[model samples]
Target: MTTAIVPDPEAIRPELAQPGSALPVPPQGLRASRNAGFTSLRVGVTALWLSVIVLLPLAAIAWQAAGGGWQAFWLAVTSHAAVQSFQVTLSISVVVTILDVVFGLATAWVLVRDNFIGKGLIDAVIDLPFALPTIVTSLVMLALYGKNSPVHIHLQHTPPGVGMALAFVTLPLVVRAVQPVLLEIDRDVEEAAASLGASGPKVFATIVLPSLGPSLFTGAGLAFSRCVAEFGSVVTIGGAVPGKTEVSSQWIRSLIENDDRTGAAAMSIVLLSISFAVLVLLRIVGGRAAKREEKAA
Candidate 1:
């Protein structure tokens, strides 16, 4: 029938009046205000710097591309050389991406999971493409596969010319992208899969492949874009033969050589557009895959 008695309001002291916090209160007024202003200034300067260096170029390119009216843009995209170049670039990029995915995964897995006598040397060699000039890779491929080359004597004639060069440059991209992700993966998961009834292929397909999908996709997209814009390497090795080996970049070079600046710019716009489109599509797919994984987890 009786209620509990309530404590007095005046019993609470000033120290106990405020909400609990781990950090002590700072001296207020000018000092705190100046500190906040300095922090804001630093953030603003960093953002401004990045925008100038990175976003400005992108904005310039976009402005140039859109300078041509919609009709001109449409005409540029529909031209025979432009269409052919698009097809060729896309085809080669796809081919190289697939090759890089297979070989890149293998190389990343070996570098991350396996430790052999020449492991460090092998890892260093994988990054050779990053340091070596693209022209060098092109020359090497030409020397390896061209008609005058001794290595080509047995094969006689194989269209592996352009593909070989593109793959060489893209190999480092895929390997580097996947290597970090592979290194981050827990070895225990792989070991557990092995301990189960899973065989080598089974473990890789079910366990490793799923985890590597995002990095593999990012690497593939990067490789594809690189192949699409590739100039020095493919041009030296493949020779821009229209209806055959003429990639977008090579086609642009040829156009410029023929003193066709407008057409070259137009074609360059096409290449940039396709690259942006593909990149967007890939990012969307990667996002969906990430969400699905989150739900599954």
Candidate 2:
């Protein structure tokens, strides 16, 4: 038999001769470290952007709010006009959100699953709210519905007019949110349900609604927040009627006009807190729904 020669283990690779051979690291480890560094860089950039854009402004508001102490903050947020403004804002937001959800879903479904003439025009028009300045939107509404117009419904200086303006502004949010989710749904699943004798409503209820729940809620929360903070349109259309049509944003503006900066900041904080709470609640509900859908799948 020929003698078999075994090459020394460390002869081929010099790294293997060291006491802590593994410490030298492999090519894969180098790539992993590079990827980790890139990820860290991305995270740092995002944090910096958020701090400058969102966190800093919020901190400034909070600090201003706290400058007057708890008693002043509490009084500012709870005064009679403030309370009425909050009520008006919440009520209109609720109405606008409901209408937006209903019409937005229908519009998204039509845009996604249907074909028609003028479809492109309609799709472009849906984004008009986003493209138009909010003040311009109020002007448009005023022109169309003011007392002098042919189709005048006299909506100016009313809660209904404010709601209308807000709904128009927020319409695109829900439609855009639900549209992508609708596009991602598999058509064959709906067909299969139909072949199994499921009615249209049954298929939609069982197959479509659950998948859309999270996105719909997310869009509603966004719309609600927008409605709450709506300033130009609400102020123009509603005219800041103290006990009747005044909303939170109008109230804040009035406070600022009166040179009550601390009160304005306090009221802003209250509005921000409410919006944050509602958004958090929606997120929790959406997460649970998403988890349930995953489990079912």
Candidate 3:
């Protein structure tokens, strides 16, 4: 009688016999076969939508801005009014981002770590700025803090008014960003620190702040970009005062009204470029911070 020889499965696939071994990669043909046609269609549709809404508009603006030579672009961006508007826009954006980071962090921490009555209500109200129209927010600020109000402070037509409006509109960005990070944090880690006799400030500085750094920077970057593009609120409150309260958006509007389409496009490109650079810088810094936190962990 001839005996049948059995093949050992582990001998055939040595990786399966080892602990903590990675699975073998599938063949290219098998991997390709696993992708659904519906997934490809969905990806194509998403790309088409993004191209229509974002890429096309940006390309059009760039083409318009470059219609004239580089000399024209430089002159347009460096003009007196354009320079002043850029300054105003940058100043307001910086102030708004700073304030948002401070108050937003506190609010996010409270919402995530504490339990209380009306917590749901407070959480819902935090998104009020996003739900309300920018123009409506401007009007509310005017009503509360404008001239002849009970508080008797005149913020309208001033830099502070512009900053306040920007801050109000972007307030929720930081809170929303930080809340998710806070919720994901392990409470036991905090408890372990406390049990080691670490003070509240020390614990936060050593542990909490390191973990939260990336999210805070990301939120601030988003808020700053939104502030740079703010129009309705700043126009309503800041009044487009020449060399004073006029921001880049209002300045671009003025240029377009005067039939300076090239100038307006150039200024728009400059503002867009600055916003893009800041966002890129923030991402790089945030990425580094996240890596450091992971290494420390």
**138-235 per-residue lDDT for model 3 (tens digits):** 88888867886678888988889888889888989999989999999888988899999999999999989877888998999999999998888776
TM-score (C-alpha) between model 2 and the true structure: 0.86
User: Candidate 1 lDDT, tens digit per residue, 1-297?
Assistant: 999988765354444454653334555786789899999999999999999997887677556555766777677668898898888888878988899999998999899988899999999998888888888887877777776887643211233577888898888888998999898888788799899878989988888888888888889989988888987777667877786787888877777799765566677767777788879988898899889979999
Which pairs of residues collide in candidate 3?
A: none
After superposing candidate 1 on the true structure, give the runs of residues whose Cα lies further than 4 Å from its correct spot. 1-36, 66-68, 153-159, 282-297
**How much is the lDDT of residue 103 in candidate 3?**
99
On lDDT, the leading prediction is: 2
CA lDDT of every candidate: 0.80, 0.91, 0.90
Question: On a 0 to 100 scale, what is the lDDT of residue 123 in model 1?
Answer: 90
Q: Better model by TM-score, 1 or 2?
A: 2
Query: Number of the top candidate by TM-score?
Result: 2
RMSD of each: 8.5, 5.5, 6.6
Q: Candidate 1: deviation at residue 82, Å? A: 0.9
| Per-prediction TM-score | 0.79, 0.86, 0.84
Native-to-model Cα distance after best TM-score fit, residue 28 in candidate 3, in Å: 9.3
**Model 3 stretches astray by more than 4 angstroms:** 1-40, 286-297
Model 3's C-alpha root-mean-square deviation from the true structure amounts to 6.6
